[model samples]
Target chain A: MASIEITNARKSYGAVDVLHGIDLDIQDGEFIVLVGPSGCGKSTLLRMIAGLEEITSGDIAIGGNVVNDLDPKDRDIAMVFQSYALYPHMTVAQNMGYALTLRKTAREKVSAAIDNVAGILGLNALLQRRPKALSGGQRQRVAMGRAIVRQPQAFLFDEPLSNLDARLREQMRTEIRKLHRRLGATSVYVTHDQIEAMTMADRIVAMYDGIVQQVGTPLEIYDRPANIFVASFIGSPAMNFLSGTCQITAQGCALILDDGTSIPFLAPPNVSNGQKLTLGARPEHIDIVGNGSAPSVPATVDLIEPMGLSTLVHVTLAGKPVKIFTLARPDLAIDSTIEIAFNMDKTHIFDSETELRLPRANEPFAAETA
Target chain B: MSTPGKSRLRKTAYWGTHYLMIAAFVAFALFPLYWLLKVSVTPNDILYTEGVRMWPSRTTWDNYTFVLTQSHFPHYFMNSVIVSGFTALFTCIIAAVTGYAFSRFRFNGKIVIVALMLITQMFPLVMLIAPIFRILAPLGLTDSLTGLIIVYTAFNVPFATFLMQSFFDGIPKDLEEAAMIDGNTRFEAFRRIILPLTLPGIAATLGFVFTAAWSELLFALMLVSSESASTFPVGLLSFVSKFGVDFGQMMAAGVLALIPACAFFLLIQRYLVQGLTAGAVKG
Candidate 1:
């Protein structure tokens, strides 16, 4: 178990840049997840750290030693690929013992290591079967078993659960978290699924367009996204954004929508009056209020999705679509009008020009510093 | 109940047409080989009298006995085996390495080199025969089995390399990357991990190049004139003379030549079938 540090790392292919000046200091035994959409350089960064890819510029150090020019074998790292790249011709035991066999370890020692890992992964009966004979989830377990048998400095997982079905993905995700806790090894996981990042990471690093958007706990990123991109990316139903202008009314600060509806804020944002702004509100933070409410905006219900645990109500507010999630199964009909109120304290205000979150006057100016 | 009966009738009709088409194709392909066997067995006295009959009234083993006991066909068979065997071996080794590189690496001049290889296959072999003979004569290579093996290997490598490359491409690149991270070098990963999975591919390449070199006539006739260096294809021409063409002896030798190629295919039929199906699915 060791800390991995990346400093000013940039990756480019000729004129096309993929990762632009990334710097991350991961602590020992930390489970950091690099989360983003596809083509966001998260997988590329993980490959670079594993030495499968060469760093275009800057340095990466593993356990206080520079590993930029070292081969992947010298770096002492293990990776589980999205395809579960087990040796198809080799049986499960052979695949799990391959690293030790390559090191010329004693035969008994290698078998012992494989036995221990197989036991942990419940793969004892599968030891004699080839990879093609195993199910998808079993192959995944064999891939992970192959990694842990070596006990490398760190484990790099590139969307290891993406190939499994949903039920199996959920099961493997919990198993991976438990394995990380038991082993206490520094692990870097990459995935485009934000929910996986939210559920599995010790610290989530949200990225977009080859840039690190935010790095913090899952709840922190969900509560205080650094910009419009992060805010829209981190949530499940996604945060709703409405383009409007700030108005300093007698009731304090209110946003005047393009359709001429006023949505009052609990406190004024650090923006000039009449300046353009974007208001962000999560689905769970909005409530379906009755008509004639003071701080509510009238909306026409468009769709209703009942999820058994919760109901999602899609409505058009001031001519812009917004989703509201509630535990109550509201008996609402489509095309019916309702008034929805935003939880003002939980809502976010962004400068439309810079697309960055603006700190509220009452709150400390520490939200967007990440 | 009626649906089941109707589906059963449809199933029988479907399979009937399927087997009929396959049986027709088999009969069409095997008719010539049957004729060869029939002519090889016919006695010399009745061959002309038989007048294109499918089977003779009386068959004799005299041609087979005479070819085996009195002719140089056995020596020619041995020479052909050595040349084809060595050609298949050398071609597969070179093709595997070149194919792996073509499948995996993106080095300088990759496209240009691949295009040059492709262009080599476009030319007729006749255009190069004179130059090849001239080049080999000075090097003491002409009139020797070694020269034939070299030429056959060179000609077969490009196609074999493409075949091997497609097989290599069907394998996931992540397997080798994982092996490298698991403490083996790249070459070690290729040798231990990838090579085992490509056995079917290697078998297919060997079988293809073997049958090709075994039956090649143009180069064998043009290159080797010595009786000791002659392959069976060139040796078969010995049955011809100004006096008359010995059809019985020639057909006997032809039947003898088919044995080795048939046995070779039978030995590798498992891997060949597997490799073809795997390649088809991947493609």
Candidate 2:
């Protein structure tokens, strides 16, 4: 319903700084996900926006008004905690209507609001039951219903689905996405799970070490991560990195691995010969070419995992581990040498010292600006 | 081939010894109460003859009637009830608030305050009884039930606060944060959400303080000198004469003193059972 903006927000416990100055501008009715590993300050930022935590420095504005000094109730935001935090003493109906009752709304109006939210959440039959009588997934629905009944300026969810089992989590994930679309409310979801960010967000804000690593659409992040941290953290069967030196020969440009295996590719324009760099290749973008193929790096197969829909082949390339994902199951012996080729079009090259993705020679500066 | 039969015998022996040990401990704990009950019913004429007998060969209700109608014990019982009831009420209120602050906040000097409370509990009560009585004398509270209530509440608060703090710690802090985000202020959230969830803890503290004040003898003896303000423990001393101790009347009054404490526990027994916080969180 409203946009939330954060400018140079930083947090610290005495001298130990947790969040170094962060700046973000969220659009109205956008579903933004803050994703990272634990202790990355995503939850801290969300709490600061919700007015639960003080911003050690900087300001946060909700709906164009700065709420840095406001209390949580004054901020007009609702949060679904990871623990569900349903009031054990109150029944489902009372839990959902608590915010309205706190505002001293008319009884009929409060009930109507609760009824509408309950209908949307399918909680009619269980309205009379207390939190102890409901299952985990039901409690989660009640938590969501409580947030929706208030219809606050925005919604903040801090790992809301992490408490449920995998099957229920999967079901609720799609349900939450559908609910968000229907309501079209501005929501900021925080989770350490990358898949949740990828599938649920209009935009994903990837963070690491208390800094914003990248902010972009899911595919943009997957296709061209801004740096090595975002590159490795976003994908499943994570992108592999190989240390090599850039080389330019008569036939074409090639990367010479630390183990002396020559991997030929179309070098990006900015790289000079003998420049040290890290090559990143996603599993799905590596092919198991024929043994004597040209422009191929010979690898020794270490392990193969046969997933139902796709198989993952683990191989050692230039003394470094790399995983290859494919639809075809390869009947290859362990320790057997095989030649593999990188799809040069899908590959990423980063300056080793900076660990930043380098623009390819063909498209010069397209990926970096995104 | 015979493993099932052997294991069955093994389990039976293990359980049989476990039950035997527990039964022995239970009997050891209840023997004093059983003896008190038996002596209260024994007729005075046969009290000496029936010494050490499990069953008093003959029993009578004379001691019970005599203690109830003929002695000042009933007044003492009333005084004990008033003192204990007020002590429990005051201690619980103070403990609940202080415990909540200890559990939920990081304030200045919190560690030092907690350590001071612990330090108060370290000293022997006898050492402070003289100073307490001296302080109360000038205030004209030394020989009154109100004085007893104040002292008892002060003595019971530190322990009760610790007990309540443990209960509050078991509850998730998220519930109150969620309540605040739901539009209630922090104080309202404490009253409407956290306090209701702590009902079991409050009940436990009340029962604990009630029993402690009800049975306390040292302070009751040291503070009150008047028969009108005397509690049951001091009134029971009246039955002893210089010539000989009135065993029948004393035992009868002792038996009478236990009824309120027992009934008080019975009233709050359900809340004493843990698990009130279940389903408040993910569990």
Candidate 3:
């Protein structure tokens, strides 16, 4: 395994730039995922690293060797495409052994390598079948197995699981994670699915508008998002943002909502009074409150979504929709009035102009530095 | 349930009309060919006696034996085969490369080049024959099989290229990229991976071009005057003289010429039937 470094890399098609100057230093054997919505250039960045695309500017070094002008085969990278891109005419064994065959490896060694990967992927019985005859999950396994059989310097996966059904995607996600554990090869995976990034990545690189929005461990990105984009893009059901103004009231720094409701937030000492700010909160942190214990706000339940393990209450607050997730299912009907409390300790405050998350002076929580 | 009888009558009427239409068209198409075969087998003595008859009163193999041994039909058959074979092979190779380029590449002037090729097809072949004969006469190209082959190849390539291009366009580009990353150069990928998948297209182009060249009479008649280089379509004219026409020998030669075209189709029908690129992509 080798460490890969992309320093100030940029990509453009003629004049329309798809990737801005991106600098990422991947550690040896690190599984980094580039996650973003479609057209955000995550796949473009991965293709640049794989040598499938030309770098418009800057340097990419793999194993301490610069490879900007090298072809994909010379770069020693393996990629599993979203379509699985298996040779339809070839049997599964031939598909897995293709790279070795190109390198003129010994016949027995090629067979042995294929058998090893197929055994690991549980593809022993389907070895002789062509790609058209295989199921979606099986074709995906063959695509992955093709990458593993060669043991390339690094693996590049371009949304390899996007074509699978949800249940199979979940199953294959664990299999990929476990395979990474066994191989310990440097891998760069690209996907638009944040759940896949959260579940499978050692470090998730969130991208938007061809720019790297944030790069950190999944927990770090989830807990200490750098900006409003990161905060909203990282979580399931997304974080809710309420436009408000900051006021240093008698009860520390408080955010006054548009509907004249105040929620307390622990702001740093640098924040001035009457500063415009936005309050951000995850739905799971907002709890349904009984009267008279904490600050209570009235909301109407617009809809309820039961996810078997937890129930999501969709409520309208301040003329905007807000979803609140809770384990306790309340006997509430649509359009019924309810009271909920925001968790003061876990709320996020952002400057309205900059949209940068303002770090709080907490005791142990790691605050993001701009 | 009482309407079952009426539904059965309606169904029979619908199918009966379909069969009647199909039968009429088949008879219209096959009657001329039937007359050719009938005349070839009828004994020469009974030609006038069985005049305008659908079937011969007496059948004989004398015409087949006489044409095979006494006439120059064998030599004409060989010349036709050589011309058609060479034309098909040359046209297919050039068309495959040009078609693949047109399908995949985004080079400058690509649209202009395609438009120019399509423009070539719009000109009538007869109008170009005079200029072609003038061009070929000075270079000693007229009255040569090579000249015929070249003309046939030139005329067939544009349509064949378009035919092959659509098939190549249907194949996904991802397959070749996968091959390139598997350690093969782009040309190697085209050869080993893509070329195999395009066999159906190649076979179809070959068959189309071959039959076209095999039956082309205008260019062959204008370009080749030597008896050695005359193609079968021109050779079929020799059976016509100022005296009475030799119907039996001409029909026998016509039947003999169908063999090669039939054999060519038979050879390529496997790839043509399989639609070799079927499972190459998701669609």
Candidate 4:
């Protein structure tokens, strides 16, 4: 196991740049997930670490040794591809033992290593069958087994569970997390699925447009996103945003919407009076309350989606669509006015011009670290 | 209510025409081969007497006996085997490597090289026969089985390379990348993982080149003048002397010549039918 350091890493194809000088410090025995949308350079960063792609300008060190010029084989990293690229001609045992056999390990030792990995992956009965004979889920296990059998310095998984069905993907996600705990190996997993990153990562590095938006624990990023992009991209039924200008009064600071409605913050954020700012709130953080409630805004219900466990109520607030997730099955008619209240302590305030979150006076350093 | 019975009758009628057309094609293809066998077994004395007959009243193995023992057909058969065998082996090896490079790598002048190979196949062999003879004569390659193998290999490689390249393209590139990450070099991955999966393609190229070299007549007739270096096709022409054509013995030699190509096809038919790489990746 090792800590990987990527300093000022940049990748360009001719004149078109894909990665714009990314810097990351990964600790030993930590499971770091690089999560982003497609074409966001997450996979490129993972490939650079694995020595599969050449770095245009940067230094990447594994175990304090620079690996920028090493071949993938010499780098001593194992990767499980999204396609589960198992050799068609080789049986399950041979596929798992391929790396050790290439190192010219003793035949008995190779067999023993394969046996141990297969046992852990529940693949003992499939040792003699070729890849073509296995089902999709079984093939995914063999791909994982191939990486673990060698016990490399680190594991690189590039959307490895994307090919499986939903149930299988959920099962393998837990399995991968358990395996990481068991081996305590440094691992870098790349995926476009936010839920995967939230469930699997010890530290989630959310990226956009080839730049790291935020890097923190799952809850830390969820609670305090650094920018508008991170705030909107990190959650499902995403966080709602309302465009407005800040108004500082004798009582406290509040935001004035275009329609002349004022929504006050519990504690004023560091912002100038009459400054353009955006209010952000998660769907679950907002509540639908009875009429005549203080500090509430009236909204018209647009749509309601019941997901059995919870309900997503879509409403127009301050002339902007907002989604509110709640456990109560509110029997509200469409286009009917309902009063909604934002949980003031949990609401986020961002500068509209810079798209950077404004720090609250109570939590001075949260935005800086987020 | 009678629609079901009417549709069933229509289905039978549709299948009836399909089988009838297939039978016609089969008969058209095999009739000449059947005639060759029929003539080989007909006695030489009755060959002309039963003119235009499908089968003769009398049958004898004298033509086969005479061709095998009394003539130089055996030596010619051995010469053809040596030339075609070597040509197929050399052509497949060269085509495999060239095809792999064309499939995987991005070299500087790949398009120019491929265009040149295609240009070689565009011209008629008859136009280049004189120049080829002159070139080989100076190298002391004329009238030799080794010379015939060389020319046959050169003529067959361009097509065989294209054939092999298509096979390589059908395989996913992820398998090799996976192998490289598993500690094998690119070449080692090709050898261990890719080459085994390409057996069906190799078998196909081998069969194609073997049959092409086996039945080639123009170059064989022009390049080899000595009876010692003669291929079976040229040897069949030797039956037409100053006096007359020996149709019986010539037909017998033709029957013998079909054996190896048939056996070669039979050897590779198993691999041709197997889809070995079906489950290697997701569909």
TM-score of each: 0.96, 0.96, 0.92, 0.91
Off by over 4 Å in 2: A250-252, A361-370
Off by over 4 Å in 4: A242-276, A294-300, A316-321, A335-337, A367-370, B1-17, B51-54, B241-244
Lowest-lDDT window of 10 residues in candidate 1 chain B? B274-283
Top DockQ model: 2
Order of quality (DockQ): 2, 4, 3, 1
Docking quality class, candidate 1: medium
lDDT of 2 at A30: 95
**Cα lDDT tens digits for candidate 1, A1-370:** 8999999999998899999998888999999999999999999999999999999999999999999999999999999999888887778899899999989999999999999999999999999987877888898999999999999999999999888889999999999999999999999999999899999999999988888888888888888888999999988899999989889877688899988998987654457788999999999999998777768888999999999999999999988999999999999989999989999999999889999888666765454233
- Model 2, residue B163: distance off in Å is 1.0
Q: Is candidate 1 or candidate 3 better by TM-score?
A: 1
Off by over 4 Å in 1: A267-269, A362-370, B1-3, B275-283
True contacts kept of 4: 0.79
Interface RMSD (Å), each candidate? 4.9, 0.8, 1.7, 1.1
Q: Residue pairs in steric clash, candidate 2?
A: A1-A186
- In model 3, the number of clashes is 0
What is the per-residue lDDT of model 2 for residues A163-231, given as tens digits with 9 covering 90 to 100? 999999999999999999999999999999999999999999988877888888888888879888888
> What's the distance in Å from true for residue B57, model 2?
1.8
Query: Residue A198: error of model 2 in Å?
Result: 0.4
Output the TM-score of candidate 2: 0.96
Per-residue lDDT for B1-94 in model 4, tens only? Answer: 6699899999999999999999999999999999999999988888888788988898888999999999999999999999999999999999
Q: How much is the lDDT of residue A220 in candidate 3?
A: 87
Query: B167-214, model 1: which lDDT tens digit per residue?
Result: 899888888899999998899999987898788899999999999999
